[model samples]
Target: MQLSSTTSGKAGSNPMGEGAPIVYVVDDDISVREALEALIRESGWQPRVFGSAQEFLSHSRTATPSCLVLDVSLPDLNGLDLQQQLASTRNDMPIIFITGYGDVPMTVRAMKAGAIEFLTKPFGDEALLDTIRDAIQRSTTALGQEAELQLLQKRYASLSTREREVMALVVTGLMNKQVGGKLGISEITVKAHRGQVMRKMGATSLADLVNIAAKLGSSCGN
Candidate 1:
C-alpha cells in the first residue's frame, strides 16, 4: 500500500500532503516496532518508533498531521491510557491498535474510544497498510479543519471593538448609514470601520465577511 501526499493550502485543505504523514509506532517489543517501521517506510510514510507509550508522549506538540500505530499492551502506560490522555487534551490523532491477545470486549472498548482499527497479532500486511492509510486520511482531514478554525479565530481576534460592531451590523444586512445610526456614529466613521474590518479580516468581499461572521456567531452560540 503506497501512500501519496495530498496536501493543499486552501482554508479547509490538509497540510500533510507535502510529505508522507509521520506515523508514530508505539510498542514494547523491539521486533514489533522495527517490523512496523520498516513496513511503514516501504509504504511511503515516515515512521517514528517508540519503545513505550511514555517515549511517544515526550515529543513536542506537533501540527504535522499524522496517525499512531500502538500496541494494546505496553511496558509503562498502556495504549488505552495513552489514548485517553490524548483525548482529554482534545488531540484528534487517529490510532490503530495491534494486540497479541485481544479479547472481544477489549476490541469493542477500543472502537468505542475512537480507535481507527484494531488488528490482532499475525495480521496480514495488506490489512495493516489499509487501516493505516484510512487512519492517516482521517487525521489529515481533522488537522485541516482545526487549522482553518484557528486561522478564522486569529482573524476575528485582530478586529477592534468598534470594527467588530461594524462588522456584525454589516454582515447582518445593515447599510453603512443604518449601522452608523444604530451605533450612534457618523456614516463616514462607519465606512472607515468597515474598511478596517475588511482589511484586518482578509475578506475578499462582503459576502465572504458575512459568511465568516455567521460562522463565528454560530460557534459562539454553541
Candidate 2:
C-alpha cells in the first residue's frame, strides 16, 4: 500500500497554517488511522496520518504546537525507537503512545523517556482526547520558551564586546566603578556601555537585566 501524509480538517481550512494546531497519527493499522483522523478533525485539530514510522519521519515538520498520537508497534521503527529519536531532536513535540500489547515495563519505559501518556488499546476516546489536549498545551509552552530563548540570543549577539563585558559584570552585582576598574575603563565609559546593554537587551531595570542574563545563561566571568 502507498504510504503518505494526509491532513484532515475543515474543507477550506489550511491545516498547515501557523496558528493551526496539528495532531500526527502514526499507526500501521488503517482502521485506527481512519478513526483517529475523524476524531482529531472533529475536535478542531488538523490530523496528519501516516502508515509507518518512516513515512511520518520523512514528512516535513512545522513549528506550530503539535502532539503525536503514536502506536507502539509500527512497520518501520517501533514506537519506542521513534520516541528515543524525537527526544533528542524534537523535544518540543509531546507524544502520547497507544498500544495493544502494553505491559508494565513497556509503559514504564515510555513514560520514563518523557512520553506524556501511554494508553492501552481499547482506551476511551475522551481519555485519549484529553491526553492529546494536555500534550498540545505542553508543546505550545515549549515552543514559546524556545522562541523566547532564540530572541534573547539574537539580542545578546547584537552587543559589542565592551557592552557584553559590562553586562557580565553588572549582573554579578558589581558597581559601575568596580566594573570600570576591572575593565581598566573610566566609570563614565562603563555607565555608557551599561546603558547600551540595557537598551539593546530591552531590559527595563537592573533586576530585569539580571533576569535576562540568567535566562540566557550568561557567564558572569566572561
Candidate 3:
C-alpha cells in the first residue's frame, strides 16, 4: 500500500499528531520504509516515511510527541550528523537508529547522542515495536514537561513588573519591610503585592512560590 504524504495539506503528511502521536521513518530502502509504515499504521499512529534526512528535516513537525525511525546509512547526510543538528535546534524527538552495516563505534556514537534504540538489519518486529513503544513513552513524557514549563512561563509572564520585583524579593527570604525598603515602598504595599503574587501564581506556600521563582530566575539567568 503506497501512502501518499501529500494527500493532506502538510508535506510528507501524516495525520496531524496533535490528537494522536506520530512516528516518522526515514530509510532509503523502499521496502523497509513501507514495511515499517504498515507496522506503524497498524499500531494506530500517524506514520510518515522519508527517503533521506533532508526530507525529514524539511517537514513541518507538529508539537505533539513523535518518534523518528532513522536508517544510519543515508545518502546525503550522515545519521549521526542529523542527530547532532536536531539536538542543536533543541528538537527532542526520540530516535531509533537502524543500519545494515552497523558497527561498534557507530552504535556507541548514536547511543551516546541519545538514540532510543540502535537496531541492526534483520531485527525482529517485536523488538522494533517494543523499542518504538518505549520511545513514544519517552516522547510523551518530554512533551508533558515542556508543555508544563510553557504554561508556567505564561503564568510568570502575567505578573506585573512591580509584582515581579516583589516576587523576586520575597522568594529571596526578604521580609515585607525589607522588600518595601529595597523598592522604596511601604511595608503594607509590599504585603499587598505579595498576596497578589501568591494568588496569581496559584502558590499555596512560600516554599512553592520560591520554587516557581527559581524556575523563572534560572531561565532568566538570575
Candidate 4:
C-alpha cells in the first residue's frame, strides 16, 4: 500500500517542502492505517502510521510541524484525549478527526477543540485531502511565526542593560540627544550604545528594530 504510486491531483507538489509537514495517521485498525498511509503518500505527502495514540506520541517530535489524521476511537488514548494532551503542552499542530460513528455532539466537541475537520467513516478522499492541505498551510504559517519569535527572543537576550535602554528610546522615536538626556549619558555614549544595540539585535534599520520589539511585546523602557 504505497501512496506514491497513486495518480491524484498534482501529486508532485510538496506544499510544505520535502520531508517536512508529514501526515501522521493514528488508528487502531491496521487496514485503515495502511490505506491512509497510501492515500497520504499518493497526495504527495510523507506519511507515518501508528496503531495507537501512545505509539504516535512516543514517536512524535515536538518541534516538528505536522498535521494529524487521528481516529476518534483509539485503544489507549482517544482522539479527544490526545488533543487535550497536546493542548496542555502548547502544541498547536492541527488535527482532523476521523471516526466510525460520530454524532453531532462529538463533531461539535472536536470542532471546539480546534480540529480542522471532523470526518466520518467512508469519507471522501478529496474532502480529506483538502482539509489536510488547509491544515498544512496553517501549520507552516504557525511554525514560521514561532521561528521568528525565537529569533527575536535570542536577539533580545543578547542586549546589555544600557543597550536595552537605548533600544527602547530609539524605538520610541527619541533622538540620541534626548535619549542621552533622559539616561543622563552623553550623546556620544548614546550613539555608541545605539550602534551596539542595532548590531546585537541584527536589525538592519530602526524600523526593523521597532518591529521586532513590537512582536516581542517588550517594553521600551523600565
**Candidate 4 vs. true structure, TM-score:** 0.82
lDDT of 3 at 145: 79
Best-matching candidate per TM-score: 2
The CA lDDT of each predicted structure is: 0.78, 0.85, 0.81, 0.81
Off by over 4 Å in 2: 1-18, 218-222
Comparison by TM-score, 1 against 4, better one: 4
Per-residue lDDT, model 3, residue 73, is 84
Position 42, candidate 2: lDDT: 72
Best-performing candidate as measured by lDDT: 2
Arranged by lDDT with the best first, the candidates are 2, 3, 4, 1
Per-residue lDDT over 1-222 for candidate 2, one digit per residue giving the tens place of the 0 to 100 score: 112335332222344445778898899887778678777777888888888888889888889899999999988899999999988888889999999888999999999999999998888889998999999999999999999989989899899888998999999999999999999999999999999999999999999999999989844335
- Pairs clashing in candidate 4? 3-42
**Candidate 2 displacement at residue 81 in angstroms:** 0.5
For model 1, how does the per-residue alpha-carbon lDDT over 107-150 read when each residue is reduced to its tens digit? 89888998979999988889998988888888888888788778
Q: What's the lDDT of the predicted structure labeled candidate 2? A: 0.85
- Sorted on TM-score, best first, the list reads 2, 3, 4, 1
In order, what is each prediction's RMSD in angstroms? 7.5, 4.3, 4.0, 5.1
